[model samples]
Target: MIGLTGSPYGSSFPYAREGSFYLSGYKGAAIWFAPVPLFDHSGVVSTFRQLELTKTKFGSIIKLHLLSLALLIVFSFIFYALIWKLAPIPSGAYPFVEKMWPLQATMETIWIKSTLPGGADVVGRLIRWEYISAGMVFTTLLYGGLMVLKAPPLLFYGLIAGLGTGAWIHYTLPTFIGAMLGKFYFSKKYGEKRWRAYAPVILAGYGCGLGLIGMAAVSLVLIAKSTSQILF
Candidate 1:
């Protein structure tokens, strides 16, 4: 129940996948269960023996974790230094922008809502300009984090996810264009009255066609890459 509902930051309900029931909470916390026995009687005893051996090695484990944490801090500092060095030197443009009252007020509001402690309730609203600013900030941070860690693009959805409603603007534009075209076509082919109902359907169909084509192109690229690697 705690795993299912308590950890709202990033929690998952207990779910069955393959032979296991998996539950996760917050960041890296997780619990999993396998219904089927993973080991025979002898194997279970061997596992117990291995557990006993682990007790004696606990100090080594602690040392290894500390070393890993130290390395992570070192790498983070290095990345920060590199980013600072590579950053463009500020020009007179900074002072020019700073003097603009409207722009300065807007920047102050964004900074306070984003950085300060309070304003959680306001920010939690479904839609707001604050959300858009937060999205942009998070996306930039995520990109830098991925670069530092040299992680895969498997979490590419994260970039889109953070953008909230803004992410759909591109997709929405195409659909709107399709809807306009559909309205005209339907009005001409059927009747002016019927276009209201049929116009949206055309856009839906148009969007689906585009999505399928995109998926197919991506899949073909992945398949070709895999096939080449296998052959070589």
Candidate 2:
């Protein structure tokens, strides 16, 4: 829904984040920028939605919204049905759809957050049920307003990164900075085209490495839990 509303190609990192299922690390990269959002701050709603709210295409938006909702319900039913048929988990436990699921925006989908070893329920069922998004709404308004004021993208990006760090939302900004430095260093030494060609491969490999590291983390967590259980 996010990618459908915001983008069709899933080219931007934000778009890919909105639609992570499309850009699995081993397969490919699609990181292109669109200029439309700079001018038209339509936010996450479908074009139909924009039209409806603005009194341009009300019925169509309602139809489209209902259609999208129906498809989602159907797809969800089919997915769970298949899971029950093929690889059923024990009663009351959900399977971990690991790897890239964590990298996605929480607003985009409902996900189960489970702690390894302890199997604690960090997020049960839907992370959110309502369509009303206070945080996204605020950020969208803030961003649109800032853009009107001629705010530099990187300036606000850095500010958000700093604030996110303070709020314990780590990982993305550091990697983004590291990638920028790597780009500069390599582009300066080699050619821009050469670095551009190799950058995707390097990052893809790094992503796989991170996955392995996550597995190691799971192992360590289990070991620590077991040791603690034994000791105390």
> How good is model 2 by TM-score?
0.30
Off by over 4 Å in 1: 1-169, 182-185, 200-204, 229-232
lDDT of 1 by residue, 1-232 (tens): 1222221222222112311321111111122221455422433444456657776465665797799999999987975565345323343323444457667676445433432344432323534668669867987888678878987543433334324332477865774576576667767888887876875587699899999999898557545533423454
lDDT, candidate 2, 72-190, per-residue tens: 99988975675555433542223354533454545222211232223333333324535337656866787788899997655455545444443344665676677688777888887
The estimated TM-scores of all candidates read 0.24, 0.30
Clashes of each: 0, 0
The candidate that achieves the highest TM-score relative to the unseen native structure: 2
